[model samples]
Target: MNLAVTAAAAAGAPLLSGDKGTTSEAAVGETLVSRLGDAMLGLGSRLPDMRPETLGWELSHALTDFHTCQYTSLAVRLPRLLQAGHALTSSSDSPEPALLLAQSYTLATRMLIKLDEQQLGWMAADRARQLATAANDPLAVAEAARNLAVLGRKAHWHDAALSVALDAADDPALRTAGRRGAAQRGLLIQCAAYTAARNGDRDGMRDLTAEAASIADALGGTTLLRDHGGGFGPVTVQLHLISAENSVGDPAAALAAARALSPKALPSQERRSRYYTDVATALAHRGRRDECVRALLTAEQAAPEETHARPAVKSLISGLLVSGRTTSELRGLAARSGLLT
Candidate 1:
């Protein structure tokens, strides 16, 4: 996905530059977010054929790529979209474009939630709220609130996250699609559980997760939030399991789950690198220093220029250096891999 971002740069220029005024800018921003969302969904649709481990690796890397790029794009595009929507709202003009603009802002808000940027994500959510209100679309408003809930989870704003989730779960517009609404509620419950776990409320986490799992079962095992407007599947549950395991300091369990989801042979270079890097971390946590080094070597070989600079990879190196048991060997390996050179 990071490489895709680089490839998308040239194509994105025309989309970025064609915005002549506030309204045009908002329109374009909406198109861009929608397009990106569609692209992600398309990628996900192809996942069934790939190995679970490989699919997991790709998802992880794509999310990392999203984290890297969403901030810059939001900063450049969001204000213009908001201003344009506001202008249309204040005027007694036709609300069609305003409604469309609101939907666009909502899409952007969803994208921002995925990026792990708290403040900017909240700002985008606020814009989405205002646009939805102006457009008189209760469904859009509910969806925006749900997105805020997700952002709050990422930011560790527990009370705010729970409130937003509850509000979304109760929104009447959510009933438009019965199974989807239930699935969305289930995912929100999972998010709340995750937040509870982070706060060290074990009972709270367990209770919430249990309820979410029950709802997911009732919803036929779809766990992804419907507000995101994509098909939710088992991967959602697997990711939640991974998070739960990690929160409990069960690196072995986390690794087992991750390994079960990753592909045997990564379909993309980016995915191959990420998979090996994760394998390194899991091995390191398990005290398998030599195996960890081997995984790191593979990651470095896969994407020599970019993978070595990854924060996770760097952190792993630092941890190993401080451990005192494998510093010399790791240093030698790093030199050979050109990571230290």
Candidate 2:
């Protein structure tokens, strides 16, 4: 995934503008925490009552901001979404508000994780799971499980991540036939593939990604999802495969997989930037210094604020500097990205 920054960036750098949308990861976390805290402290009355339809519309926009890595906008909107969601979930007897609340919490979990706040992200993930379970919606439950698995993986709990991903995928609730089922099943395997990579289970990564690929092919290029918000479909599967290969230290295979896909085909700027970053990582590992720099530059263009905030990108820059080219161009790139700091 790709990201921007908030007023409070994860890595102690202020956000820089990109040609594409970019925002602050720091602000995203701080804002969510503060806003949620206020709501919990009985500030709910300060916010206007929102209908389910209005809340849903705002949620869609917030999700669009999320997919595009617009964290500054998210910082403004997400807190309000949470408040409105809480209000709706409490006032309305309908299950829609509850499901919407779960989805909003899941979105919060994603944002917090990206900002490297895993412990705090846990709250959002668990809240999502609780709401989803209470709603008894299979799709909501599946999405919540996926978010929980992501939080687990981020926290380096590989075994637990893999178990939850597989269990969520195999839950009878997800066994129904057709497109949604296929998407959920494919997504779980992708998460499992990610866990396998983190656990250094190379063969499992390969097998799980292959299964996901087969499911994608079965969908006949239908693109089961049109946005990263859904987090499924053929494009995401390819991205996950590349990430798994890279995580397993197979840079050559990672680059090969990256080359097989087109960034333009990705639905959001965040994923496109992530594709470039993955390519940069693979190139860096191969000592293809010039190409690595080029790929990172491409990533920055896609999302400058995000590129700097990523741990992997920071590590790659440090590695490149250690290898000691020391050219003016390289130095300039490093300075602009705040890698020199």
lDDT of each: 0.54, 0.74
Cα displacement (Å) at residue 314, model 1: 6.6
TM-scores for all predictions: 0.56, 0.85
Residues 103-123 of candidate 2: C-alpha lDDT, one tens digit per residue: 888887777777666766788
Model 1: ten consecutive residues of lowest lDDT: 1-10
Q: Model 1, 41: alpha-carbon shift in Å?
A: 29
